[model samples]
Target: MKVLMVEDDLALGDALGRVLQGRGFEVTRCADGVEALAMFRRRRPDVVLLDLSLPGMDGMEVLRLMRDGGSQVPVLVVTARSAVQDRVLGLNEGADDYLTKPFDIEELAARLKALVRRSHGAPELRCALLRVDEPTGAVFRGATPLDVSTRELALLKALLARPGQAVGKEDLHHAVFGDEPVGADAIEVLVHRLRKRIQGSGAQLVTLRGVGYLLIDEAMTEGPVAV
Candidate 1:
């Protein structure tokens, strides 16, 4: 799992980073709120560990920006502020969990895992015969893993995250291409590629014309199953 750790304390961040790495999590460290928010927007992480006090921008403002931008990635606030009002404010800003500073490392790991599991809902996401193993981020058809590129997998995960909804082209672009500069029809091209890749899985990549794209079970769109 990937974790974006936003902490300004050099020693603390290093120690926590090592611990998280030992627990098999890929951690990206950022010292300030600006850099953290930039990284968050460029690519989605499994979870975010945010500190309330940050330079460049405040952690609360970062939380607001994340929520306002419609990113549903779970965030856990870790700070020295243990007051009830502070906790309440963090939750109101869309943090899924909160842990004060000087917390147990083991408990922190447990909370992070729980947040990821809850955000993913089930271990597997399904549509027709296609599935994604949330724990592994692997796309599968029946018992076989589908051969797909990293970008393809990212796009698939994004669509599956909001199944049946027309995800805007802009959002898909950010999810797949990130900060890379691409042409106007870049998302369309990627969608076309993904559509062909999942063709055997009985899932359809549907375009919403002026809207964007969505995924659906082809079987569901077929009428009456021939009765």
Candidate 2:
């Protein structure tokens, strides 16, 4: 995947660019927000890693401008600010994901993969006769279309993307809520709604005791059942 990384710190920027390149990603590094925005429009990268502090324009302003200009490219905000308010503000401004500084490279890669996966919009997730579009937020059971909210659609996409894997609650939380603080039962509520909407669609939503939720189609795979 191609990525644009905007960071004022030259050393860190070089290190990150190298790391991502090592992982088979084409990276373009920019030292300021203005350059970052320009490169973004010029390259149209698959993902953007934006730093909060920049030389010319601030990261928040850049994000606002991108959204105002109708740029829906997935953005992952990387900043030193660990405060909840800072993260919240970034999310509100249009960041798809937020990671504080001093983070593990592995986690960063995972988040990037998730973001890119969502952006590319996986073909079709089939569980029995049901099918879903990971990109356009379209859901279908056989030939019928089901109405679903954006949040519910995102939740379903996150679940369907993993197939049989058990997606942890925290990961799902981040995918759906971004930086917002949601209650423990929030996932349950959303799952309930999804289940209702997908009724008779040959797909099932199951809970894994203390782990998290899983969406399964009986025809897809037979494994250890968690309910």
Candidate 3:
């Protein structure tokens, strides 16, 4: 699993990252809120561990930004703010889970895994010949893995989130670009590129005009799936 740790303490971050790595997680550490937010958008980690007392931008503000921007990639607040109000605030602000500092590493790992599972509705997603390992960020076409970029990965993730049904372009836009400014037609471009890349994967990316896009496996494939 890809884990992003937004922590200011160098020693702690290093230790925790190593621990998570040992547990088979891909960890990326960031020291402050700005880096955390930027990395969250660009890297698209499966789960986030955020510290509330971050420099420049507080963790709460970062969480708010993520929510406002419509990124639902599971966030877990790990902070020294252990007060009841703090926990309440964090959950209210869209954190999937909360863990106080000085926590057990095992428990942290369990929480992260649980959050990821909940996000995907399971640990693995299978759509015909395409398979997505939610934790490892590995998308496979049968035994061969697909060469997908971060943006393309984000798009595929969104599509897989709802198999066999059309997903609105606005929602996908939020997932890929967040608050980043770009042309309104950007989602269409992404769909076009992703469609080409996913060809012969026994999966289809379908465009529903006046609606959005839908992805389906061969088993569910029927009719002309696009506009």
Candidate 4:
């Protein structure tokens, strides 16, 4: 699952990101509310982990904007505000669940899973022989299980999420590296690895110059000669 974590605290965000990634999640984080909202629209994460005290815009306004924009994606408010009124306000403003800061990491993870499960059922995604077992975060080719790193799985999942549609390099970077400070060639290297793994799997990863990469079924694209 993809999670858009909107938190201004650097330490907490970094720690949570690492933990969540270990627990079968693709986490992209933004510190500012403005950037968070923009990422929300672009990334279309399965769920959002929102912090009320944010810069540029408060969490309440961000939630309001999301609802205003007709987004029904689940939002979980994670903040230090533990007052009953605060929780009520958050829910009233469109938050699906609330989590007070300093909470247990396991609980947070469970809540995230619950929200995503309720909002979007865990459905397996596929493109030809490349299949993503959403529940276990496993990638399979036909009856064989293919070994893929977390980053590779993230990239493949992102492409498979939208079959036959080209995904931009920037978006792929966000999905794979999140906010990590990697080199410009990081994505290229990752793509090269995945392109090799999916070879002869009936799925082709085609690169569109100046656009990005897309996954398509090779069998579906083949046609008879036009005489």
Candidate 5:
């Protein structure tokens, strides 16, 4: 599962990121509320860990905007606000769970995992005009369906799983080919094929030198290789 953790505290963010990564969760950190909200829309993370006290905008406002914008992604409020009213307000505003600062790392991780599962497991993966219906292995461009081979569909699924973020070639290979043997540059071939399929999808394919590839709306991009 992917997590968007919005915390301005550098030390806490780094430590939690490391712990979550150890549990096989991909994590991205955002320091300020404004950036965090933008990234949330771009990344479509499985869960959000938000600090109530934030710069640019408060986390509460971010939560409000997300709900107002029709975002169904789960959010967990993690802040130092331990008062009863603070917890009540966060829940009322749409936080899936609340965790106070100086919390037990293990409990936090467990709660996050539960929230991920409670949010209906894997979310409906959609980015711009590209949408993947996991149940049917169907790919769509708006209301229309696109013809795609199994390999092509798998490649797109992996790429769009984490929209606007670079997905490594090795990860793509595993996602697409599994344990099957494949020649070098196999992933690039698949990427090229899929690129043609998604042309004019409102999102474009981007290569980050040696890092990997990501699909993003050129207009929505704030920077290269970042949502």
Candidate 6:
């Protein structure tokens, strides 16, 4: 999944980014709330890791604006503020989960997974005809079984969850490769192979020139080209 981490502390940001990336997340790190807001609008990450004490526009303000603008993406507030009122305020402002500083990265990952799962309105990992049991890394397409690697399943799950949206190449890269940057050709190769596998399954995977790929359901194929 893709995450936008809004943190002012460079050291902490780098550490969290590296750790989260290692744990299978596409992370975009922003040092301040303003930049976070801009990136959030552009990318619309699956989840947002926001810090309450941001420079210039505070994280609370950013969350308020995001809600006001009708963006319902899940947000997890990671901050040093541990007060009850502080946590209450952050929740009231639209954060799905809160994590205090010095938190375990594993716990953060688990919380994020829950938030993302809830945001997608699915009790489990499912998208249209595809269903994935994350714990066992099992996958099924409709009633037909398909054997897919863990990384490929991750890619498919991400794409299927946001069907019809043109997921950017960088975001996909982050989702699969995380901390390690992989070549664009690698992404292309994976998508190409995935397309070939799903070609006759009534799903259309279209490549947007100069942009990214879109996984479209058969019903949405006639809509405008995704970009």
Q: TM-score: which candidate is best?
A: 2
lDDT of 3 at 116: 76
Clashing pairs in 4: none
Give one digit per residue, the lDDT tens place, for model 5 in 25-139.
8999999999999999999999898999999999999999999999888888999999999999999999888888888664576567657766886566777888876534578
In order of listing, the candidates' clash counts read 0, 0, 0, 0, 0, 0
Give candidate 4 regions above 4 Å deviation: 121-227
The true-versus-predicted C-alpha distance at residue 30 of model 2, in Å, is 0.5
Per-residue lDDT over 1-227 for candidate 1, one digit per residue giving the tens place of the 0 to 100 score:
89999999999999889878866789999999999999998868999999989999999999999999999999989999999999999999999888888986745765676578778774446788888765345679878889887778778877887877889998888767655688998888888888888978988888888888888887778552210
Native-vs-model 6 lDDT? Answer: 0.78
Candidate 2 lDDT, tens digit per residue, 69-140?
Answer: 998999999999999999999999999999899886645755676678778875456676667754334689
Candidate 1: the clashing residue pairs are none
lDDT of 1 at 116: 86
lDDT of 4 at 47: 93
Model 2 residue 150 CA deviation in Å: 28
Per-model TM values vs. the true structure: 0.54, 0.57, 0.54, 0.54, 0.54, 0.55
Best by lDDT: 4
Over 13-104, each residue of candidate 6 has an lDDT whose tens digit, in order, gives 88888888877799998988889899999998999999989888999999999999999999999899999999999999988888888886
| Residue-by-residue lDDT tens digits, candidate 4, 45-156 | 9999999999999999999999999999999899999899999999999999888878867557756876797686654578888887653567799989999987898888
TM match of model 1 to true structure: 0.54
Candidate 3, poorest ten consecutive residues by summed lDDT: 218-227
Q: Write the per-residue lDDT of candidate 3 for residues 29-141, one digit (tens) a residue.
A: 99989988999999999999899999989999999999999999999898998799999999999988888888866557656765777787773566778877654456798
Model 3 residue 213 lDDT? 89
What residue pairs clash in candidate 2, if any at all? none
